[model samples]
Target: MLTPDRIDSEASALTGAVRELARRTHFPVSFGGFVDGGNAHISAIHGSRTRSLDGLNVRVMRGLGGRVMAEIRPRATPDYGAARHITHDYDRHILGEGISTLLAVPVIVGGRVRGLLYGGAWASANVGEVVMKPAFQVADALATELRVRDEVERRLATLDGATAPASGALGPASPRAQGGAATPTEPHPSLPAAHREELRESYAELRTIAAAITDPDVRARLAHVEQRLAALSGDDDTAQLTSSVSLSPRETDVLACAAIGATNAQIAAQLSLREGTVKAYLSSAMAKLDASTRHAAVTKARRSGLLP
Candidate 1:
């Protein structure tokens, strides 16, 4: 389940994507929303002429946006009102907005439709690849952001559950203690072998997500989450070294991937950097830590509390 904050964040992401779609396609109107309770509620609207589309709920298989949600593909009509293939369920809202030509694209994540984006114009016009391509790109970017958020939330929930007090235990764990308060110098409780591995994986995934995100605010938030994951490793012995050895963000990201046994090419692909660039970052990190090899660099980073 998503918290109120997460729901608001998702809505903001959708709004940003929809605004970009309108600008990219040069459409007079653009709007979209994520699926909830089997309906795609129009929560974000751009360049609207009136309140006709405001708060509109589009049901699956019921209208143009609905059909796109159901089909999980891009669909459009040069003449929306005259198009007989789709039901007229949203005619009042859509036609009321004077949308004669419209295009709807699905935001698919993990092979499932998570949301829908629509671009429309008041005058009838053919929707070609030039417009469809950018619309699709915007939807794809939105899907990636949504997927990253879902993964981060799931891992955080798991972390919470793992650190909670077990039955018959006298007190909760120190990291996520009962009151959720811990001193800056307090050592994190050791995690199970499996949990530690999960934390490392989550850290690597967060780095990959940060690389692909275009929004600086979202990327910064992900970076904060990465730091939390790193601090949960219970490496208090390295507290002194952590302050002594500083690695740039990109260098740390490369080292994190390397710690997970990723090859240079694989790290390059994950971080969206060239293989040579990956090598340079790795070398720079190794030099900072005085390590001789990639494996040594990763080990030094782990001991320095630079990675989970």
Candidate 2:
């Protein structure tokens, strides 16, 4: 079975995958990633679309790209003004890119518009099935990522957990999602690579101690800490959270610290963890947050109401 960690790692890979596809494909390819709202704001604008001439807050059902998302289908338009019904709304953004003919496809997942993938040309060229083929492939790859993340989440949820509405409807002591109390609740705006590396070391040293420690009092303390870190470490939200959210409690403490901008060495000194162990927790949390960057992960968490 795919572990939560694997699922998140794979979803992240798709971002690069989709981007590379646009760069390699001969068309003036661009991908505007999924925005939080119904209207698809440009998350990533590539090729010609990179040259922005308008503002954000693009409306659906306006231009070639907007229409594609509004209709939840693929569309090819030879002239922007020709689509008089929708042209006026998004003409500026598209025209600035020097687009005379364009194809826009939505990256649909679970009946929702995750993002949009586009291909266009400067002249009125007929972008037939041949031109459209690879575009669909790219969109498909991006859309499929959601399902993989969802599956990992399901598996992670099944491992002796608690279910709180992500909205923070419950109190702080409502208990951890996976049957524990010490886990902290909050989200990151983004999680950096250094944060991830910190958590990585934490999880490793923990395993080392779990197997060999023999003192009764120390063993009991370690056992409790392990369960908490396990719950914290193992959550899967590739589109939403990353390595996995299934972490043990102590691990959650580490994540909370990093979320607050704690350095690995600082976290180590504060929590009495070796700097290495703190790195492990940060890395593991980065995966659970499914955030490629520190800021993004933090945003995802706050938006989900994870960070209270």
lDDT per residue for candidate 1 within 1-308, as digits (tens), equals 67888888888999999999999999989999888887998899999999999989999998998888888899999999999989998899999999999999999999878899999999999999999999999999999888878877777787667656566442545434543434445566657878788888888888877877777667766876787777666444445243478898899889989988999999998888999999999999999999999988877777667777
Global lDDT of each candidate: 0.84, 0.56
TM-score of 2: 0.47
- Tens-digit per-residue lDDT, 1-308, candidate 2: 55665444544544554575566556665555553566765555456545553344456776666777778888887775565656666666677677777777778888967677666677787767776777787777656555444433443353223323355554566555335533333332232445333433443344444444333433454455444433343223433233224545555566555565667787787677889887776677667767786555545553333432
TM-score of every model versus the real structure? 0.90, 0.47
Please list the residue runs of candidate 1 whose C-alpha ends up more than 4 Å from where it truly belongs after superposition: 165-186, 234-242
| Model 1 lDDT at residue 123 | 95
lDDT score at residue 36, model 1, on the 0-100 scale: 83
lDDT over C-alpha atoms for residue 104 of model 1: 95
Model 1: weakest 10-residue lDDT segment is: 175-184
